[model samples]
Target: MKQGFRLIALLAAIALVAAACGDDTSDTTTAPSNTSTTADAGGTTTTTEEMMTGPTFDIGVTEEPCEGGSPDRGCILLGSVTDQTGTFAAASPGLLAGHELFWARVNASGGIGGLFDVDILDSAIVDNGFDNATHVEAYQGIRDDVLALAESLGTTQSLAALPDYIDDNMVAAPATWWSGWNYPESDAGLILEAGASYCVEAMNAVDFAVSNFPTGAATVGIVHFPGDFGEDYLAGVKLAAAANNLDVVYEQVTLPIALDPSQQGAIDAVLENYADVTFLVMGPNETATIVGTVAATWNASGTDPRPFIGAGPTWNSALLASPAGAAFEGGIYFNSAPWGPWATDTPGHAALRASAEAGGAPASNFVSAGWVEQYPLKATLEAAVAAGDITRAGVVAAANSLGEVDYEGMVETVADYSGNSIITSSVVSAVDAAAPDGLTLLAGPFTGPTAAAHDYTGPCTG
Candidate 1:
């Protein structure tokens, strides 16, 4: 079964590359020029237009030495610490499934440089999430053994241990970014945001709301929990609203990690002063409670129609299914990743389904992000191994070198990794439960000129 799946993955990747190559049908690989040519005998002509060549991969085969003592049977150890219990547990299992699929295929096809073995350590940081100390301990536990770290989800915990991580020379494939993704130029080696910062997601969601939501007073209210994730997003919504000329009204901060604040009066206060657009920048459980509270109150009054808007984290499939889900009838959100089920035709999706089915994961849209993220993570590490150097520096360099990457055609735009901050595309989707797919895209990747392209908009500005 593993061999068959690996074969399928290779064929899929080759098919994708072939399709992309076919899209480029130009010949004259023009070289760079200095002088301009004359168009009308005496008139000055524009400089010759040069065709841009895409990135080149090491297509040929190469071999490298294995790092560990485990019977040199062609393998390299890549470290991993997943949040399999806490807030991120929702996507943790699926992400692991993706890793399994990627490496399974890679090893089956003769491994990286004819060697393959991914050593993963279950970083037992679950529900409430891991602290900085825990993150450092986990890394220290296996620092001397692995070639590179694949995926570590906690931004706060990881950022806390960033200093040691850099000193140890570990190249992390992808890290979940909070508002503070923009570190100084010196820390560039340690930062590789897989998706857009949560702030970007907030800004995009606000932008979508302004253009599409039912027009009214234009006042906006943002409710958030008092954590890095919540605070950062709340700040982002305000910034986006200010730039877009939208009003900013009531804002609240609840306790840490509590789904809903114990104080009912506080919750009612925010609900009472609602605006045309309300941004719930809280975690999953709290988001559900807030929505449920509002819905129950409004339903009791028998009247009052207001649109609630939330960032991606708050828009969980389970939460939306709750009674509070009904309150968000006109709610909308901005997401950094593609809508999973909606993208059934994408290569990423095909690969994800194959892996999930094989691994016994529930085939749900929510699991697709972890599913797709794992593929690129795997491919990035494989490329690093192929480079013949498994040191921390090698891993980081390999990650940065991944140019214009498209995940099996799953992601809409190619990932851009040029500056200190990694920038990728963002998708705008509306929270419409009535639709066949539940959520729908409003405007899209908006990969236009004027949008922040590879530009690092620094930390929280509130």
Candidate 2:
């Protein structure tokens, strides 16, 4: 029996290795092109057209202060706001570490355009518990000074302050888990950068479970944290499941961050009522707790195959701290960014590990996001500045002008606005638990359709 089990394990490992090494194919996409034309005619004899490019300027990033460094040349800022004090604080340091490493690399390369420093601005406020008003204030504090907003961990805060930032022509690269912000692509041109939207992430999870579990995952269950973010995901799951003909036997919504007794009970009620493959959309800790409790209960009762599978923020390193985390063995999930301890091969991943070692900070999934986003931001800003415009209009114009800026050997795909640049979807790295850590690249980032205008494109409908 033991020998057979060992053989099974070895085969699984081989399959995982093959999956990871199988494909590094790029998703080919084209962004809409932006062109500015100047025309002149003399005596109706000859006509000539000229393209006037914008001014070149600095791109700011989160930075560390150094004495005796050149002043004007290295003073550019790389702004950051994270939930270091909030429920998601566990992942904040990793995000910051990745940002810092990317910043260091850029600065070592003589800074952007040889004039700007990636100045690091941190709004490490806790927001007194995800209050919307506090988010507005946090954003206000950093909005004016930074060249561009790099990574925001708080979704509520990002949504609240986004309008004002856009009004001021500030560009934002957010970790928004909601997909509703996208679609009809012309909307919210300020949201130049985004992690994989929840819609895609949820579907990735769905696809993984169905493919891997097969006969085991005939029915589905959903347990989501309550909020615009969770709700958006719920909708996506339904859409994807229905389209795929997957049956959903259970669905329940819980609180945004906490899983107190009552909240846990609410979750338990759903799991009890609808038994099947479960989808979790809560944080790491909560997911760990629920998985341990629910799995033990079912395992003890001899529920036969047990809950098939699911995905959520619950799969990060933080969850591994839980003894019950082992319960997630063989579980599947979807990841937007490609930087994690499981993945040390990518440039961004290596940079993150180096940063973590240098700073003595623990790396998490969020950190990988920070690393990848820097590449996009750096590439976009470089192209924008090179196009000659540093003003908001110029930056937007340059973004629109880009065909596809390649970064770290990958093309950063984005939506081509008339003058506004937006990133569409990209393939996400699919993750599972095993040797080499199961960070597999999945489908992506195909350039979806763009909207006529951005502001009127989101849930608020402008």
Candidate 3:
């Protein structure tokens, strides 16, 4: 619908070219046409005319250049629906900065297919506040203006918009790592997810704890919130526990709103079971409260502190300054991450750091995550361009056809979109005050036996 003005302008240009050719009175100097030929996904050769003119598009693309792009190039606009002022607000800024930085680099290097510059306008980025309804509302507002979503954060929040996304033929790079994103049956092949799922991460976490702390980790406890984020991880923890012959001594599911001033319920559960190791699948605040309280209680009782492994979202560098800082520093907390931290030695990490430095963005693992998640979308768009069709439906086709996305070693390359190809390895990190993100790599990008051997038929939640 937004293509009206551009279509009119294109018609006018065609009319002028035709009129000039018809005029025999004046000596007309014709400019040489720039043309190229390429092969499509099916190996059919297409010329520039066929590739450029045969393809049709409706919204979120324009013949006009982007604000900072060369006048000769067109623009492809994308949107982002994410938390800017909600439960995940602390990490959103860095995540957004990472998106901007990634696109900036892309535009600077000559954007997709060397034909269009990509832009995610600030006006098109709406704050979902980590709420499902808000996420849907934000998406509805920008559905007609963006060719695709560059970032859609949260598991349930993204799921809330799935039906509309399918109807609109919109593709998105999800910010959450829910296991459901791996299956086309669950995501309808619309979500371009990066890294390992939360479920697999939990499996690896349990495997890491049991293998590393053999003397102390014979039993495990799980503390989580109720929905996909928590329950997904719980499923994997249980699977790994059974695989390793470790008993699940405790399971506590509590809400963030309920645990606010005090995480007494979760802490009491931990104390009662006194499991050697606990897997946390809650927010950073909840993580800090439970770890801090449990550590203090254990010290008071003169009991040795037990190790706590947390899913990626449950650890933030800011927690290092909270009351739990000492407990984290005492080697009691570890993070199970989808990818390496900000300081990982990889080409992708280096590029992200350079972009962040140029933009003066703060160092955070969320920034690394945000940067990593864009790869799948970038690959899909490129694929669509090669297929001579960048329309919404074409983009969806490109996404489903992708074989593997190169993250430049930020994490293991996602082999494919199938559930069987789901990445199972995870990076485990330990609290370190001196590390760039206050966390240092302790073990992984490694796949433990449980995750490596487990059959992934569908989403853990299902």
Residue 182 of model 2 has an lDDT of 49
Model 3: clashing residue pairs? none
Q: How many Å off is the CA of 99 in candidate 1?
A: 3.6
Candidate 2 displacement at residue 5 in angstroms: 68
Off by over 4 Å in 3: 1-55, 257-259, 418-421
Total backbone clashes of candidate 3, pairs 3 or more residues apart or in separate chains: 0
The ten-residue window of minimal lDDT in model 2 covers 1-10
Residue 380, candidate 2: alpha-carbon lDDT: 62
Q: Estimate each model's TM-score.
A: 0.71, 0.71, 0.88
Q: Which stretches of candidate 1 lie over 4 Å from their true place?
A: 1-73, 105-110, 117-128, 179-187, 257-266, 320-344, 400-402, 412-421, 431-438, 447-462
State each candidate's clash count: 7, 29, 0
- Best-to-worst lDDT order: 3, 1, 2
Would you list the rank order by TM-score, best first?
Answer: 3, 1, 2
For model 2, residues 214-271, the per-residue Cα lDDT tens digits are 4555577777766656665666566557656878877787664443634576457655
Runs of candidate 2 exceeding 4 Å displacement: 1-72, 122-129, 181-187, 257-262, 305-312, 330-341, 354-361, 400-402, 407-462
- Candidate 1 clash pair list: 74-116, 75-116, 85-127, 86-126, 86-127, 169-392, 259-286
